[model samples]
Target: MQTTLRRPVALSGIGLHTGRPARVTISPAAAELGIWFHRTDVKAADPYIAARWDGVEQVPLCTRLVNEDGVSVSTVEHLMAALAGCGVHNAMIEVTGPEIPILDGSAAAFAQAILGAGVRRLDTPVRALRVCRPVEVAGPGGALARIEPAEGLSIAFEIDFADAAIGRQRLSLDMGNGAFVRELCDSRTFCRAADIDRMRAAGLALGGTLDNAVVVEGDRVLSPGGLRHSDEPVRHKMLDALGDLALAGAPLLGAYTGRRAGHALTNGLLRALFATPGAVEWVECDAECQRRLPGMGVRLADLAAVA
Candidate 1:
């Protein structure tokens, strides 16, 4: 069955790139509404922004959604992942600023809050986008992303960094059995310390600090709390992929593979998936298929493993 938040859940924090403070609330919506963002600050014009792949702005360093009216919401990947991971199919995310908060640099907090608020199953059944054939996209720096047929949502990601602290890491997981909540939710976004000044000079990462991101300097990790996992950088890449894929506007029953891919490449993959003929088909998921999809068997207790 499709689901929505049982009640409203709220959070407040600073935007990762914009550095602006905002309060966001995820409230229940009618079945089939999908996920959307409403800018509470923009009251005069249309403030609604669809949280779909076509709405993506293809920006670097974050996932952004812009409506036809030019009102945009930035850095929405984590919150989107939380909603999709927790099995909330329909929601209205109301934010008081141009970007959603980058709380903890991971979806653990969002997952915890959503689970605490509970999920209400709707009368309608879930409709998932099943990949019929493989579709791939290439990005600058040799990044590649592709999705192919699979029984459930499976993710395999590989990342390589010149920094010794994050040389190379890879992970593959079947996103079932509460795997998202337990394994990937706590992995935080990371960056190289040498690029911090350059990024800041280029007007990015203004709100970034040691607390929210894992900073690596060659062989050293500069973050205060260290890492939540050994291969945290790669895990976070997978987490970001999940969030980006959520913009498909439905659960994807397929295997996603990302090779050194970021938000742009993932969005490109989605664009390719939809544009190619015979690449995907929407089907009303059966009971067994629904059970195998991400979030189906998730429980609030699974958050205990986030950290």
Candidate 2:
């Protein structure tokens, strides 16, 4: 069966790119309602932006969705990942500003809130996108994003950076059984010190500070508290991928492999998956398949106590 949050939950913070304060609320919706964002400040026109892949507007720093009326919301990946991982099928996310809060720079807060609010099943069932064939997209380097037919959500990501603290890292996981909360939830978003400066000069990162993003300079980490994990950067990338995949508008039954891939490459893979005929199909999951889905038998106590 599909699920929705037991009640509305709110998170307030500043946007990573805009640096503006915003309040975002995740509220329960009826089954099949999908996910949407309403710009609460824009009361004159239609402000609803669909949370589907087709609505995505590519921005270098984050996942953004735009509506027909030109209203948009940025930095939605962390929140989306929380919804997918927590098995939330329907919601209406409302934001008062242009970006979602960069709270602790990870999805942990969002997941913990949803679990505390809890989920209740609706009478309807969930529909998932089933991979029918292998599809892939490659970037300038050997970087690639590929997906193949699989029984449930699985991801394998590998990253290599020149910085000694984050030179090479790899992680693979079968997303079932609350693995997301245990492994990827605490990993924070990271960037090189030079990149931050460049972004700042280009009118970006206005809302970024040492607290919301991990800054790496050569072999040293500039973030005050340091990393939550040894290979925090790569784990965060995998977490981002899960959020990007959630935009498919439904759960995906497949194996995702990302090599030095980021938001663009992952979105490209989704475009390719949908455009290529016979590449994917919508399937109604049976009890056996449902059992294998992520967080199938997860309990609320599984979330880590991090504050």
Candidate 3:
């Protein structure tokens, strides 16, 4: 069955790129309404932006959504991932700024909040996009994103960085049975220490600090505390892939492999998947199929083990 939050939950923090304080409230919605964002600060025109792959606007360093009226909300992946992992099928995210708050730079906080608020099942059966054929997107700099047929949702990711501390990490996981809450939620986003200055010059990561993201300078970690996982970088990549894939507007029953891919490439893969004929089909999940989907049988106690 589809699910929605039992009650509205709110979080506030500084935006990573905009350097402005923002507040976001995740509210319940009816089944099939899908995930959406409404910019509360925009009073002149339509402030609504659908959290779907087709609404994505290619930008540097984050996942952004823009409506037909040119209203936009940036840095949505973490929140989106939390919604997907918590088995939330419909929500209305109300934000007070141009970007979602960069709370801890991971989905842990979001997941914890949603789980605490509780998930309520709707009467309708859950639906998922099942990959019928292979769909691949090649990004610049040898980045690649691909999806193939799979019985359940799975993600495998590889990332190689010049920084020795984060060089060549790889991992894969079947994202069922609350695996996302246990494995990937706490993995914070990371970047090369050397790139910080360049990014600041390019007007990005303005609100970034050691508290939110892990910073690596060659073999050394500059963040105040060490990593939550030994291969934190790769796990974070997998978390990102899950978030981007959530934009499909429904859970996906497919195996996703990302080779040094990011937001743009993942969105490209979705576009390619929808454009190709007979490449994908929507199916209403049955009892057995629901068991194979992520978040099936998930419990609030799942948060007790997460860090």
Candidate 4:
């Protein structure tokens, strides 16, 4: 069965790059609506942006979606991961600003909020994008992403950096058994300290601070309290890939492998998957497939320790 929120869930915080305060409400939508965002602050023309790969307009530091009228919603990946990981099939998300809140730089807060607000099943059946063949996209160096047919949604991620503290890390996990909630929810976005100046020069990263993101310097972690996981950077990358892939407009039943990939590469992978004929097909998921999704058997307290 498909699902949506029983009641609207609200979240408020500062946008990571825009540095603007914003509030967002995620309300239940009728079955088949998928996830869409409305810019409540935009008083003119169209104020909505469908949260899909086709709606994506930018992928520099985060995923940004723009409507036909050129109105945009920025930094939507974390909230997206929260919705997808929670098995939310339909939602009406309204934000009072241009960007969604950064929220501890992870999807944990959003996950906790949704679990608290609760979910209700809809009468409509759940739909998922099932990969039918191997699809891949590549970038300079070794950055790449690939998807292949699989029985369940799984992620294989590998990241390497010159920093000794984050040299090389790899993780592969089947998303069943609340693994997303228990394992990947709290890994925060990270950046190299050397990039801060360049980002500021480009008039970005205005809201980044030591409190919300992990800042790394050479081989040392500049973020206070260090990492929640020894391989947190790579885990965060996987979390991002899941979020970006959620733009497929439904749950995906496939195996995703990301090798040193970021937002752009992940988005490209989705484009390639959809552009290639017979690469993907929509399937009405059976109970068995549904049971193996990211949030199958998830509990609010699954990540209580991390929370």
- Give the per-residue Cα lDDT of candidate 4 at 167: 86
Question: How many Å off is the CA of 200 in candidate 2?
Answer: 0.8
lDDT of 1 by residue, 205-291 (tens): 999988889999989999986878889999999989999999999999899999999999999999999999999999999999998
- Model 3: per-residue lDDT, tens digit, 41-62? 9999999999999999999999
Model 4: lDDT equals 0.90
lDDT (10s digit) by residue, model 4, range 1-307 = 9999889999999999999999999999999999999999888779989999988885579999999999999999999988888878889999999999998998999999888888788998888889999999998888989999998899999998888878899999888778888889899999889899899788788888988999888789999999999999998998998899999998888999999898888999999999999999999988988898878667788878787
Best by lDDT: 3
Please, what are the lDDT tens digits per residue for candidate 2 over residues 1-307? 8888999999999988888999999999999998889899998888899998988898897899898888888999999998888888899998998899998899988998888888888899889999999999999779999999999999999999998878999999999888888788878899899787789888788888898889898989999978889988989999999999999999999999999999989999999999999999999988888877776666678886542
lDDT of 1 at 25: 97
Candidate 2 clash pair list = none
Give per-residue lDDT, candidate 4, residue 86: 82
Candidate 2 lands at a TM-score of 0.97
Native-to-model Cα distance after best TM-score fit, residue 141 in candidate 3, in Å: 2.5
Clashes of 1: 0
The TM-score obtained by model 1 is: 0.98
